[model samples]
Target: MLKKAILLIVLLNGLSPIWGQKYELKSIIFEGNNEISTSRLKGVTLSKESPMWFLQFLNSFSGLGAEAIYFDSSKILFDLAALEEYYRNYGYFEARFSYRYELDTSNFNANLIYTIIEGERSRFRSTFFYGLEGIPDQTYASLIQDYFNASNDWYNQATLEQNINNTINILLNSGYLNARFDSTIIFRDTSANSADLNIYISKGNRITVDTVIINKKGEGASLVNEELLRKITGIEQGSYYNQEEVKRSQIRLFRTGLFNSVIIIPEQNEVSANNVNLNLDGNIGYMHELSPEIIVNNQQSAFNIGLGANFIKKNFFGEARKLTLSTSFGIQDIFNVDFDNLIKRFSFRDTTLLGYVDARATIEQPFLFGKPIFGTWENYATIRKQKDYNITYYGSKITFEFELPKYTFVNFLSTYYNIEQTKEVYRTNNDSLASKLVSTIGVDLGKSTT
Candidate 1:
């Protein structure tokens, strides 16, 4: 069945045999490269997911996943350049790399061998900051301290770029909309392999927002209420031009599910002095998503088949609300593999009696009572046959989730369940109460946000 499944997918996927372009990678060997691992580089290289050794051996004799990975010399040059750029980003400025490939035309296979020589690395000597006369002395000092703390002995172009951006953001968030940085990298004692960084801070005039405009991509899409947008963004006229606040507003609004994409831009005022307004275009509206589920079991004891469907109504109420209707049915051990007559407890039932059915409806609301809290309510019913008894269950659950600091969430759930069983499916006379009422409460920590 595994072979048949693979063959079926391949035939339908339109895989054709093309000569001279089909060869699997034998091995990727690297020498004199020490800073980075081969596995990391291979992950970036063009290769399909690695199969087990047995699969490779099988492919050597037979054609299994034969078209998965084929060698193309055209991509090797780009990959080599990518490897060099990767090393340069890691402070290996003087790294030299070259590659050689050995291919066997008879067997249609190849081996890649790479040689590399990494030279001495450049380190930081001293950092000098200037032109910060406009910024408050205390603020400038704090920014410098933060840069030093974040660097912590690492001297690379990437780190310096990040440090500079962070410093600029600090000033921009502090209401300095026109702030700019004059920076340079001076190699200090190249023989000693040390570099000096000089960043001249120009904290331009502090500014304030003069206006706020809310515009939608479509003429009138009722995905989000205008009042709600104003409140959630927390941006208004006469407010400071705070970049952090703008970013937070973006996150908060995007979280609402009202927009598929969001971008907030600040436009400087041409006539008004030290004043700017914001322009944001949101791609808004609702979408209907259909998801399918499939499960297969070939094990003797658990010869089962399950099929399910989920119809999700995204933004059901013109907000970040979801209403989902789903159903699932499973055929469990229909063939009665374990034909145990002595111990019927462990025996499998007939095909009709071995099945289970489930149905459910759920609604999720991300913002409850105008707060950043998630709430969900679910109602469900299920029926299953075990041995000769028919068991039925009905339940409802209420869940509330809250977002916390550092990408963490806490969830609280309360459930009520009612279950009953009967020996005869058609008559209620043989029915017995399995459970009158079962209530449960659970608290989950570190839940996901999406």
Candidate 2:
């Protein structure tokens, strides 16, 4: 029994050596057949010794069955082909791999050849639009053409969708309220190796104005009186609303200077036949203005002051216009001294003091790009008394001014003056007429920070 057990142990030990003596990798031959460099492949594998070759060798058996352990030249070629395919999907179509296996008495060495061929870049061929109706054909054509020309180089799903959204906004501002577009996009590949895109849009409806209403508010009363409101409404109760008319009316109301805020809302009147109702609300506030000035000269220093208040009303004659009525008061002081020399000798000296008051009325129209053009006529009479003389001056003047791009200017002006003087025992009267045409051109040097 002892001899039989010893023989069994020896048999089991003899089988262990055969099981442990499986296939061991001698060397790895990397056939680099790719646009990528052979150095890059080496960097990826990074296995210089034979013992480290097993892990990388296993990767060569991915699609093959697990039972196949020994890798031949054909198997290495298959693995390199797989790697080349991986690079092709990433826009590197010209990538290729070639291998050289050098066998020695006891080991093997691998030399890889990677050939890369970069091809022409691909781009989008055409962009198309469809299903857009109820929108102006000219506008649609211009927008799409412009966007295509601007974004020809950039091809992506996100950019295509953004272009559609921008087109929708343009329609909205042009008074198209019911506009929509589908996100579905179709790409057509042609024989020329280019892609064309087709987009579908749905333009729902076009809206128009039918009618408008005006509402007024003030601190203690209505901004526009009931009678004024009645006159300002150019349309009847059932007239079709006009956007141009509404805009004109808003400008007129703003020119009044009485309203601090104005809002125009277009409300749809379902009961009326295709008519839109507009609500205009205005908030009225007081009009306040001030003019103060100071002057210094060799003879005398003087100060002049003025204050004004006014009320504004719009559409006085149902023409969507504004009319303003204003009143103002001003005061001034002038101190003067006179010196005389006769034959190099002092002869006489005189000093005087004067005071005056002025009142006027004016009519004006609002203007764009400059100050408003106004027609003003005034009448003034002043009383003045000096150390040796007493006088009264009266006159009228008409002036017109316009604002220009480069400078503010007085286009035309005319003035008439009459002076009546009295000295102790003598009285004299003089009348004069004068006119002036003034204008100026200059460059504005100020820069805008906003």
Candidate 3:
């Protein structure tokens, strides 16, 4: 029996008016279901009650809530059949399903009620695996004892299917590139209310990489070299095939932001015995962009409006590097300020019409020293005038980030250093000026599963 079934229900919110139907399905209730929850049983059927009464009440005023479901006698048989099929998949082989409805003619609402007879559930009597030979003995044992341990539990098709996929992943990560799930057979004994499960898998010869072909598309492809992409992939000739590493490589390449699309295709058709060729295809987009925008901000409890522009150059210099430059200017307290002399007051020394001025430049390198580490450098300058203080600042920072392989205590690591100079002047005391230089260095390490 299939574990998951996609049930599509066509809602006829508009059909009631045409057919002059009066009863809207107000509630769906289940009774005598000892093993399965009512919510789960409802999820498997096409029949659904309308939204809650409060939601329907709110819908009358705002027109945004779950729509009403009119009673459809024609769908009762299909709903019951779906319920029976779901029960069988849950190992309730002798289950029975029946439904009744209560109609409130005065209110023009109907309540659907289902009765379930959950008979004896079948348990797994024995389970067997075939065709997982030639892999490590411990791996086979772990798959049996840990991954697919289905002891004393009712026969659940979904759990069995999920375990099969997990076992296949273990095989693929262990270099069995051609590993695949074949089929599962279940023998049910109605008299004993038990089942024997047989799962078959084909783990073909463990494969190694014979060669990797780098395929590029779009105009910006030449800006990044094949060597950098190959290093990013970490898949080399004569290396054992690992699906996890292949996925990680794809993620690394994508994190560069140089390519719009990336795909690592295993050339299994070109396999020779235990060796196969892989293809890494990347599609690049336009590498240069000049964007301008309007910035609205709340600074010092005042609403401010600004204009900004950014120029970005992708694949700058080489090796999938990126360069960005941006600048913005905004005025303070426009409601209380005079714009008649705005151009005359636009001076660094004049604080009358000044809000803030900020400019920044950044460069990003995908990798450093032929390693997985990523590096970034940024420099910025700013000037601001508020109700009490006026300030000017300039700063620069460099950061390096990288991710460790799996099974490590810390998977992500970052280190950065920043130095800045700031000068501030107070409005009340003209001579009260402060200037300082600050520096900081730190490291961050964390384990990430996403």
Best by lDDT: 3
Itemize residue pairs with steric clashes in candidate 1.
Answer: none
Candidate 2 residue-wise lDDT, 1-450, digit = tens? 999999999998986754444333345544423344554554443332233444556656674323323324445555566555545333333445555544332323333233334343234557677767556777687558645764435334455566777777655544454457766554533234344667776655455555456577776134346444433433345443444445545654565554678767777668743456668787766433344433333221445444555544443443223444445443334322222332344222222222333333333333322333323333444443333444444454444333222212432332222222222311232222232332333223332221
Candidate 3 — which residues are off by over 4 angstroms? Answer: 1-29, 46-77, 91-114, 119-127, 137-156, 187-196, 269-273, 297-303, 334-349, 405-412, 429-431, 435-450
Which has the higher TM-score value, candidate number 1 or candidate number 3? 3
lDDT of 1 at 99: 86
The clash tally of candidate 1 reads 0
Query: Estimated TM-score per prediction?
Result: 0.53, 0.38, 0.75
Model 1 / residue 56 / CA error / Å = 22
lDDT of 1 by residue, 391-446 (tens): 67777888876545431244333223333322224224354444455667766665
Ranking by TM-score: 3, 1, 2
As a TM-score, model 3 comes out at: 0.75
Task: Provide the lowest-lDDT 10-residue window in model 1.
Answer: 415-424
- The better candidate by lDDT, 1 or 2, is 1
lDDT of 1: 0.69
Best by TM-score: 3
List, residue by residue over 142-223, the lDDT tens digit for candidate 3. 5776334677687787877777887888888878998899998888888999988888999999888887789999878877
